[model samples]
Target: MKKSNQQLTTIKTLFLGLMVLILTSFSEVAAQNDPVRLGFIPLTDCSPIVMAKELGLFKKYGVEVVVTKESSWANIRDKVLTGELDGAHCLYSMPFSVYTGVGGKAGSEMMIAMMLNVNGQAITLSNDFCGKVGFKQMNKVTPVVAAKLKAEKEVTFAMTFPGGTHDLWLRNWMSIAGLNQKAVKIITIPPPQMVANMKVGNMDGYCVGEPWGGVAVKQGIGFTQIASQDIWKDHPEKALVVNKEFSEKRRTDLVKVMKAIMEACIWLDNPANRKKAAAIIGKAPYVNAPADVIENRLMGNYDLGCNQGTEVYSNDYMLFHKGGMVNYPRKSYAIWAMAQYVRFGYLKEAPNYKAIADKLILQDLYEEVAKSMKVKVPNDDMKPFSLTMDKTVFDPNNPAAYLKVVKR
Candidate 1:
């Protein structure tokens, strides 16, 4: 009887050990699928992440996400760098800038996992400049700025961050219009603070993301002189980015996040859904503006409010998803940015464009998620995009030549 009891106890011990192993395996899987924390600035371009969370799209893809509204781009960059956040709705070129050490930390491995949206930003001129020059009349502003310089005064402009898309757009516009970028003083200001700074006469103009630009117009302090699309139609704007470590360790979570965002992007592109997008993102904790303020401009109904009245751009405006390859992380877009950096003296010498783009774009990851989500992507990653304002065709294959022809 004692021998029998000992055998029974051994059997019980084996069963408990097997159960523990099974529970451990389950716990490991559960830990691998924990909630993803994502960050975004309070801007219209952040609609993808916002929509995903709001619509339960993130959960729908078997991933839980918490979207945090950050104070500035710098904060977003730092948190993502330190692994405080899993990913973020970031400036399209920010990851590249960080990687190549132009305007951010040098050699920080980052990836633009998904292209979020395009053409939502604009350059707004303070009311002071409105009396002199108006919408799309970039040629007229030169004389006014020249006069200001003749008076020995500084004409200041503000962008969100250095070596960011806003900076690139502002510099590109100034360069294409023959304005000396060095002659004008350019500063960095948070997107939400743009209008207030202009009101206090701290800045003459600013290039910033949407809702804020529209907010400036509504406040009667400034008018948008140029939509970013006018400079380069359908240019790549904000992106969803993650560092290499997170990508390597938690690719499954990243794929789920991308799927959720891709669905949101598709929804945003639909005209029927844009009103809902405006309403959702315009709430207090998101963009903190009225729905009308974000909705009208978001749908391409532009009212400069600078005595120019309103203009309609329709499908050519800010698009979350359009054309066949709107969200594809094209290497060309990345290459073109480097070319611009060289032209503007931001970089003394051009880095290997293809190599940097390949590292930073995360095309394979995007396409992998796209395939799983049944979203069709381009067969080739490279695309030939044009810069109409400069009248120069940027050959991504030869970014070096592209930079040589651009205004220095």
Candidate 2:
């Protein structure tokens, strides 16, 4: 009996040891696949990153992702530049700006793994101005007419950042309307505060990304003068930005991050997910607006906030899913943004825009990630598309001439 009891004790101890070994192995694997932190601003189009985390797509691909909400684009740029962040959902032009040293302390080679979204922005005019101008929709009135009417008035307009996409869009929209940028007082305001500032009569008009513009309309503070899609169809808006050094050192991890986001973008673009995405984004911590306000527009329903009734716009607002169009990073998209930079005096000369775009966009990396995930990448990553304002086709092969024609 004593021998049998001793044998039993030895067996129990061995079983316990084996259990510990298995547990330790799992813990190590989990640690190895720990989340890569991603930074983003609080914009509706930031859905892919947000939805990826919410839906567990990141985990499904053996990645742990933590999404950090940043207050401003500058914060997003600075954090990524200083290595405080692994990557970010950033302005499409931000990587170019950082690489060329145009904004935020110069000479940082910020690279974009993919263009995450496009064309879901708007220019809003205050309701007070609507009453004064006697126009039902500010967007319908030509900028030349608007400027002539408000020439004597200050006609203050605001953009989210000085050297950001919002600024360029606002300037381009005004120029197309025949408003001299120098004549109108252009101010910079953080996007989140846009609606509130306009409500308090601090500004007459503003151009900003969605949810904010939708929120402004929802609050009866402003009306949509123009959807950004009208200014440029499927214009590149935001991207996943990282420092070139980090990308080089952590290439595998970078590819994983891009893959995860690409999956999230796919999920977001689904028509069925629109309501759910708006509900998810409308939470106080995200967009901080009514779900209806976000959902209707997110699904391409636009009201313009003057009770003009909602209209179904096309797929101008993108979250990257659908037919493989979103993940393919285009060098032409980056170069077009650079052209705008030069047009607006943010860049003195072209600054080798093509070379810089090629360096930062990483189309090859995007293709590899798509292939590994069995996602189809478009054969032509870059295509020529014309904008309505100048009716100029942006040929990637002839960017210099394209710029010259646009300037003329």
Candidate 3:
């Protein structure tokens, strides 16, 4: 009897051990088809992520996904930091903030596994400043803002978040036009609430991603002073930001996710499909704006309001996959953003810009996934580029020198 009992116990132990090993070996398998909760703000650039889940692309790539809309960018950052979210659609400059411990969050290692889209954001001034200001003419808006500042009026301007792309664009736009960003009161507001806040007379102006920019014009609350592309043609706007743990442990899963989004980007680029794309993304659960509000701008038709009237945009209005020009995560752009952070005092001084870019922007992994799908990538990682609106040159080789010139 004792011998039989001993044999049974050993058999049970072996079986359990084998089970553990199998589970551990296929952990990625479990996670790949498991539900990954992703966070996104209600904005047009979030479409790839939204469409990826909605169109069954996430499942097609083996990642069962959930898209939760967040109230603010800060919430998106915090949730991802806490592991409450698996990944997020994020601001171009946001991962840098997370990696650096800026914006009052403990430094969390982050990575940009993919670029979502580019050139669809804008700087908008309140309708009260409508006739008072002109499209793409910050020269006219500067003095009125300056006067309000001098009088100690609220002179409040809002962006989605500090250390976010919108804030940087607004700051650079004002700085180039000789408006002291220091003097003007800058506050953080969520993207969807922008037009409502303006209607309530809460801010003098704001910079945010579409279709809020477009909605503002539609509602007669504000006008786009400038599209972000006008400032820097084809500049990157949003990206698929993932936490470091997810990038390292679930690398295969990340590849799957990236491939799916890249496919969606390809889908988004085709003009023939944009109307349907716009219709799907415009649903209440996604961007929650009218299809017309989102569709027109998504197709490069711009009102350029404050009565500027509707006109066909000549330049690249927005791009998801412009033959990889706007898709690849450029290390140089990250360096330029870091230089701006230093300039704006977001960082005490620039840390190793290259190190940060290398750590946070996973170009190798992106290339691997992109190449598997036969998607073309930029031949060079570093590119020579300058800001169109400000004429500020961002030489990737010498960001510090570029900063010095921009400072003057």
Candidate 4:
């Protein structure tokens, strides 16, 4: 009886050990197969990510993606920092802003993996300035704004995030108009809420990505004063920003995800594919707006609203790939972004520009993916580029000089 009992105990121990090993192996495989969780704000530029998932490009690249629609840029920033999201369709300057202590902790790292899209954002003003500020009417903006401020009326402007593309656009617009930065109020508002807030009189004007600008015009609450491309043609707007751990530890998966997004970008850039792309992204689960409203801008046909008439953006329309010109995470652009922070008082002085760019931009990974996809990278880093808005030349090599001359 004692010998029998001993044999039964040994059998039980071996079975438990085998079961534990099996469970462990299963867990590992499950984790490896788990979908990458990416977040997106409900804007038109999120197409690359949405289309990637919708088109099964992620699965084709041997990974799964779960794209979550986030409410605010602040929410996206927090979740990306806390690892709640692996990455996101993010503002091009957001990671840099976070690392430099503008809107987030000074040293928190959020990595920009690649450019998502460029030149689709716009500055929308309420009907109060409908005739005073026509499309691309930068010259006329300040006087109207100044008149309101002169009357002691609340002259306010809002952007999606501090130190973000829209904030810089708004500030740069304010700067060019020679508006007193100290006199007026500048606040943060999320992109989707911009139109609603404007309708309820929360702000006089706002800068945000499409199709919110398009939506505002469609709803007759506002008019697009200027598209971002009018400020700087082909300027960087949104990016695929990821957490450091995801970029470093899950490199293979990250590359796959980027490749899939790149493929989607290529598809988005094709004119024939844009209508279908717009319809897909307009569904309730994605952008959650009417397909026609999203399609109008997505196709580069803007109804500029409030008797301003229509304008067609042929060459400078929203670019997703532009045959790789739009996707290469350019360090020069990052330098310019940081320089704007200095110019606009977001930062008192410039951070080490190249170091910050190198640390935050996953250039090597982008190059690897670009090569795999046979995408051409424009060798334009550290070069001087001029904005169409003011013709102020930005030499990436001398950001300080650029800042010295820009209006405060």
Candidate 5:
């Protein structure tokens, strides 16, 4: 009887061990299959992530994604750094800014997985300057600003974030138009709050991504002064930014997500599908704006208020995938953005542009994903490009020389 009991106890131990192993394996698999959480600020540029989830592209690519609508850019940066978010629809210059300590902690690593979309951002001015400055007539604003400064009234302007794309655009406009940056107060305002702040006469102007620009015009508080593309035709605006750990550890899953977003980008570029996309992203959970407001600018139709009449941008509207050109992460673009930081006094000195660009931008991974998707990558790195507004040529190969010649 003693021998029989010992054998039964050994058998029970073996069974329990086997069950533990099985449970552990199941838990590991479940953990690996957990959903990737992505965050986005409610703007039209966030369409790629939204479309990816809504169109079931995430599942099609064999990954789960939870899209969170963040309230501000600072929140997006914090959550991404803490691993609370896997990735985000972020400003193209945000990671660089954070890494360099212009926007966040210096030396923080945020990787640019790929470019999400270009253009579709704008600078809106209050009705105070509506009659003074019309679309693309940024030169005319200098006089009004001078008048304001002469009157001892603070000439306040706002951008979505410091050292961000909108900030650079607003600064560039001010520089070219000869407006004194020091004389004007440039504050940071969240994209959604731009129109509301303008409504209360809090700011003279703001630079932000759509559909807020559209929203501002719709509310009759402001007028579209200039589209971002007009500043630099097809300029890089937003990106798919991921944490360093997520990019390194979950590389395959990141590739899947990139592929899915790229597919959504292709879909978004299709002119016929934009109306549907606008309707979907404009919902409360996404951009939370009027569908018509989002759709108008998405289709390249701008109802520029202040009697400027409507203008159609046939070629330079918000581009998601223009034959895959818009999706390629160009290091030259990053170089230009960082150079602008120095040019506008955001950075005290120039950064190691090539090293920073190569480190932060995951070109190899983007190439891998692009090749898998049969997408053509553009070979336009380290080349000189000109802005449409000022015709200032930026030669990425020699950023220092370009910086020397450009007027601040």
Candidate 6:
């Protein structure tokens, strides 16, 4: 009987060990299978999404992320709103526009977890138009010359989307050139079709993100009239945007997504890894353009193709890894875009722009995500930045004054 009791005890211990192992395995499987879906437009700025997937950053953070390539910004916004996409590599103004019920169907509120990239957008003018305007070089052409030429003809300007960052940049560029946007015909052309549209003379100029701009200049169909960086240095371009409902329901998952993106951003910014990044972006599925076209601009070396000159510009065209400050969603950055929206009449009037910016930008969420990853956050992410043309200083603290100054 004592021998029988000993065997039963051993069997009992074995059962407990098996149960513990099963529980641990179940926990691991649960962590591995938690789904996080992210959407992206096939632009160069979508590097964060690609890099995160390639580098396994999502898995490192206990997330199984699926990054979907969206056809258009409209699709991205709509899918995210209707629960088709958990988040997306979105236009900087997308969250704000949706929140304010401006872009798509009304009453859709969106939120951005972080800013993904700055600069790297360009305004491309067709070679035919450049010849007609008698502008051999983009930099040599003055705003006055552009305006004079524009007045002589009904110049059609194209942007990727209405109420997008590209649209705002295009409008702001025209405004600075003293050209009335209403006087010029403006149309929406998808970024992928920008080159084809310009080739067919459908548009005289277009403001779009790379590698379409680079592709246009490379294909000899158009010339880079102005790099958006020239207009606003390190301008906010894209962000990781999601609907408010997603943020509320999956707060932890959303934060994890932000953290993974932040890590990918850091990885992409590393100078040593730029060549790899260029090659990665050049793949058929992502930017799907020539490796050299993506490589040159990714390295800050630009060939405008309109002029016989090439130069190394600033590292203003950013992706991912610009150290600590680049990934943080600054309130001022959001407000700056809103100010441009107001400047160009996209917004009827600035309505508590900062408060609206605060609601969409999600600086508090960015900080939490960065802190969780042990990434250092900048103390003054939101600060004053003056533009070269108007010499207007935008103060995040005093947004009303900033708007008033812009209006004046």
In model 2, what lDDT does residue 101 have? 65
Global local distance difference test of model 4: 0.90
Better of 3 and 6 by TM-score: 3
Off by over 4 Å in 3: 1-23, 26-29, 104-106, 150-152
lDDT of 1: 0.86
Q: Which candidate do you rate higher for TM-score, 4 or 6?
A: 4
| Runs off by more than 4 Å, candidate 6 | 1-34, 131-152, 403-408
lDDT score, candidate 5, position 283: 92
Query: Hey, what RMSD does candidate 1 come out at?
Result: 5.2
Which parts of model 1 are misplaced by more than 4 Å? 1-31
lDDT of 4 by residue, 1-408 (tens): 999999999999999999999998887667567679999999999999999999999999999889999999999999999989999999999988999999899989999899999998998999999778788777788889888987989988899999999998888888777788898898899888888999999999999999999999889899988888888889999999998887776788999999999999999999999889889999989998878988888888999998978989898989999989999999999998888888878887789998998899989889989998999988988889988877888998888888778778
TM-score of each: 0.92, 0.85, 0.92, 0.92, 0.93, 0.85
Clashing pairs in 3: none
lDDT of 2 at 147: 60
The candidate 5 region of ten consecutive residues with least summed lDDT is 25-34
User: Candidate 5 — what's its lDDT?
Assistant: 0.92
Error of 6 at 369 (Å): 1.6
Local accuracy of candidate 6 as per-residue lDDT tens digits, 1-408: 999999999999999999999998887557435687888887888998888888888888777888887788888988988888888999988776666555776446778888888878888887865554332243344453466565796678898777788988887777566565666788988778888888888978899998888898899988787788877877778888886777876777787778788888888787777788879977877877888888778778778776646756766765564666677778777777666666666667775766777667677878877887788887775678876455678886766687665632
Error of 5 at 4 (Å): 34
Estimate the TM-score for candidate 1.
Answer: 0.92
- lDDT (tens digit, per residue) of candidate 2 on 187-297: 878788888899898888898888888888778878887788877877778888886666876677777777778888877788898889889978876767789978888
Best lDDT among the predictions, by candidate number: 5
For model 4, the run of ten residues with the poorest summed lDDT = 26-35
Candidate 3 weakest lDDT stretch, 10 residues: 98-107
Each prediction's Cα lDDT score? Answer: 0.86, 0.77, 0.84, 0.90, 0.92, 0.77
Encode model 5's per-residue lDDT on 165-188: one tens digit a residue: 999999998987888898889999
lDDT of 1 by residue, 201-277 (tens): 99999999999888999999999899999998888899998867778778888888898899999988988998999
Better of 3 and 6 by lDDT: 3
